[model samples]
Target chain A: MTDWLDHLLILPILLPLAVAAVLIPINERDRTLKGAIGFASTLVVFILSMILMRLAAAGTGSLPGSGVYQLGNWPAPFGIVLVLDRLSALMLCLTSGLALAAQAYSMARWHTAGHHFHSLFQLLVAGLNGAFLTGDLFNLFVFFEMMLAASYGLLLHGSGPLRVKAGLHYIAVNLAASALFLIGVSLIYGAAGTLNMADLATKLAALEPRSRTLVEMGSAILGVAFLVKAGMWPLSFWLPTAYAAATPPVAGVFAVLTKVGIYVIIRLHLLVFGTAAGASSGFGQEWLVTGGMLTIAFGGIGVLASQAMGRLAGYSVLVSSGTLLAAVGLGHDGMLAGALFYLVSSTLTIGAFFLLIELVERGRDAGADVLAVTMEAYGDFDEDEEEEEVGAAIPGTMAVLGLCFCLCALLLAGLPPLSGFIAKFALISGLFDMPAAELATAMSAADWTYVTLLILSGLAAMIAMNRIGIRTFWASIEGTIPRVVVIEITPVVVLLGACIFLSLQAGPAMRYMQATADDLLAPLTHSERVLSAPRAGSQ
Target chain B: MELILSAGIGTLTASGVYLLLRPRTYQVIIGLSLLSFAVNLFIFGMGRLRVNAPPILDPGGVGDLARYTDPVPQALVLTAIVIGFAMTALFLVVLLASRGFTGTDHVDGREQRGD
Candidate 1:
């Protein structure tokens, strides 16, 4: 039993992949069977991730379960290894949780739109888990490609003209990014002489200046690829369009996809270029802070400029990514903890929003939004009153959807009474209040810019959500109440309910997040554990 | 020899970038393929150019360590090639679908007025 537990780290990556392969050969007509197996697999992975998270939270000392699982009983820094600490475990649990909701939401008619939806979805989860858990730079690239391949299929699922168009651009841009990824990875390999992250951390400190410069240039290029995925402005023009055009359930899972980029950035940047890395300690820190603020500004403007609900949700994803990026660049332990909290809450909200948009837009005429926008642009007229007469009473479904929309809006805009507010509060306070006396410097110009942009972006989301909400729910001239299924709306409720739960349990969650932040800040301890883990049976 | 390899990578990259910015989808696909090829070579060259050396270690332990090439980049290049090939196939299919769906070969699915 203990031996089996020692191998628990591999299950999150392996289980979904096995299930996906099994699902691929099954008949697409066996929808019920496929759905059941997929959901069961995701649930089990979620539970496993939770167990792993608990183990990680307990501490790495004397724990055989949560540290490192070497493949084929090979030693670390030689064979591929999976390391489970607080951060990766948190990500695994979050991915599976979102997968459960997304898989459930897809069963309500979206699965029948195309073949292999369940298989691709499972593959996506497996790829995400692998990317999060792998401790090797090359392995990260492999998992990233796997994730991208699955995403390309999912984005092109439910083939429409719009989807095909967006799919072309998305594929092209990502291919270019992949090329860059290879260049960076190989460049780093050339300079560091080892691919294992822990091994590199030790080797990098002793590198000559010329090779270190080469490695930094490689990392900078690598950062571009990640930033493109994280939706940092300019590089992020493809994100909103591609995400908006995706089928809702796929888009819902995609809410966590951008976070993969942010994850790698935080992981590699801190692990490779941390305080112990001699002269390159703060390399790319300024770039991250500045680019993150710009992303927030761009996403805020995009949110306001967007006329479609799907695009609004997509831009919200950018806003979420930007906030996390800036928080990551700040390098404050408390701020990182708050950023992790914000990551969980905001991802869930944006995912629920994406799924809800499909159900809400179901009964409305295709061009009704365009008409509404044009009408608003032309100014209020007597026609508005006659349109108001068309509304008599709110149906039960519309009422529930409106309520969910309000919850999502409040969460996205960081309003009071939800986890979003708590996360932002924790984050801002964490920025201001330092735990150590020496680190308690006054807020710099950049910090103030970040705070100002953060608040302004939230305000922009509020205005956009309010405007779109009114147009969607109340002021529509020809809008009919969308008939939503119980299964469809339940996932949204569950996701929002999770946010409320997080808000209520803010104390424990923050503690866990702060612990994660501490672990992240202290990279040496992580490298030490990973590098020193014994081979199987040798211990 | 080093200069030649570098020049080859540079030319491929330049051509790929130029084609990538073209207005047509097929050109973009070809450009991506070229760019991936350039990257694969770059990754391979990162292991350092050696005249005649085995990438694998001899079980007899007779070979000098310095004469052996770094096997990691070779392995990495193989993975990169496989992924890049798969991606190119996918992009081709998507390109065809896009071409058929909108009845145009332009990257944006329709020809813009000015372009």
Candidate 2:
């Protein structure tokens, strides 16, 4: 790696932190300046993430600075370390991309609703970047707390009665989860005698049976903490309500927050309890698969039951998280690649949908949804029904919004001609496609169940989206056109446009995801790279 | 020493979990604080409850694991405490705001029908 590029590993976290610090002292009245600063820094981080992704793709263990970065010139296994690889870079890229959209969308109006919106948003980004990049388990705890703190502030942004109510539940639940996190981390440290993840991976292989069981117990508790955030079944009651109550931009970025939980689960589970870990390999895999399947089923029900668009969007996030979790538990390389693809596509689509919901809901009555559901239930009981032509003269803004809504529905439902379809297709094919040596065996029942649940969830999303979309666009033609700014709508377009681009470039994107999966599956190589990397000033 | 410490942690955690399931927001906040306290003590115990052992290295350039009380847990506990304190403050503020907004302290922001 080049000297300059070597330092780039930390910039994603630092730039956001520095920008947030600068924005903190600025008056809340200087909304434009704060928004501008936040946007500029986010754009820079996005660009840097792109470059790092390219670097990670090209390096492949041969190039310098491609993997492990030690902080403060300290050697790994003893000091703070950050690992930059295909997966981390991809997550960073996803985060910054979502942040840029949210920041832009927030500037239109939501940023003005609160004090220090830009600072909180930037801090949230910094926390996310830190969580994604850090290599130490305890360091992960700190970053997770940082991220949760910022999310608390952001979720409470634009506070009203509903937001305050939902924020209370969100805060309380996450606080409990954080307590669980500390216990898990401490137990792991006690058993393994190290906090660095790479070192833990190495140590786990040599641990005695009793200590291995202790470590496994710790990790299972740790997994529970993450599953709470990931919105798994029976642990996700707060998600739909809290997410629905948040402001659009905050909710948009919040879509990625659940993925962070899934990210840590995948990272730690594979690294610490991977094939090399004697007596502990593949621990908790059954729980993940079962919990994930149940989550999908629950999310599907939530989607169908939701009369409100915001809650629908929230449930969609649960479905997305569940799909990724189940795929990760399967431990197949092909399925993992497809899951990564689905993660990106669904995140972007959901982010755009959240932003678009506020716009779509702008001109309608607050009670319109309840009224519509009632009318639909009781055979259109309203006396003054319009018998005119169904197609009204759509304004340009409404036209664009309708198109975006259609795309979002298509993406969320995994319909044809979009990245969602390709992702689901890849996942299904990967599940059934065993190696040539095992061609005699048929698909397992678990695989069959996963495929059935996946399709059913998509169908539920399709039905719910169609119902809501028709109610908003076609049935409610009498509603006024919302006065949307160019700034607000542009982010939605950019996000949905990115989905289109992903579909168009499916070949290369799939290849990248496959490579990332290859890197993730091989925990031995990953740990070796992290543990063997020299200190910055040494050698 | 381990017995006493573990028993203390167990008691705190049990009380904390009970309080956390309460409906009032204030109780929830207290529960969270209690939980954090228990977790901090538990983490502190993860260093094996060493007594009269130096957390720092000896000046004579001898570094031995048997002589040193593991300082990493102390650092971890400190971080957890700081974050826990900040989170408690934030949660309290939210609780007050929700109370003010909804005129209730019930976790649902409204009292149940029978209650």
Maximum-DockQ candidate: 2
Instruction: Kindly list the per-residue Cα lDDT of model 1 for residues A1-539, writing each as its tens digit.
Output: 58888878898989999999999999999998999999999999999999888888898764573389888878788888888889998999899999899999999889888999998998999999999999998899999998999999999999999999999899899889988888998999888778898888777889999999988998999999999889897799999999999999999999999999999998888888887788988789888888898899999999998888999998999999999888888776668888999999999999999999998889787776666667678986645456545538888998999999999999999999999999999889888885566443667888888889989999999999998889888776565777788999999999999999999999999999999888888889889989888887774
Q: Provide interface RMSD per model, one decimal.
A: 0.5, 0.5
Question: For candidate 2, what TM-score does chain B get against the true chain B?
Answer: 0.93
Deviating ranges (above 4 Å) for candidate 2: A62-64, A382-384, A388-392, A435-442
lDDT of each: 0.89, 0.90
What's the DockQ for every one of the candidates? 0.94, 0.95
Fold similarity of candidate 1's chain A to the true chain A, as a TM-score: 0.97
Q: What is the DockQ of candidate 2?
A: 0.95
Report how far off residue A57 is in candidate 1 (Å). Answer: 1.2
- Residue-by-residue lDDT tens digits, candidate 2, A1-539: 46866788899999999999999999888899989999999999999999889988876564355467788878788899999989999999999999999999999989988899999999999999999999998899889988999999999999999999999999999999999998999999999899898889889989998888889989988899999999999899999999999999999999999999999998988888778787888899888989999999999999999989999999999999899899888776669889999999999999999999999999788888877777788877644666664466788988989999999999999999999999999999888777777744666677888999999999999999998898898778456888899999999999999999999999999999999888888888898899889776565
lDDT of 1 at A13: 87
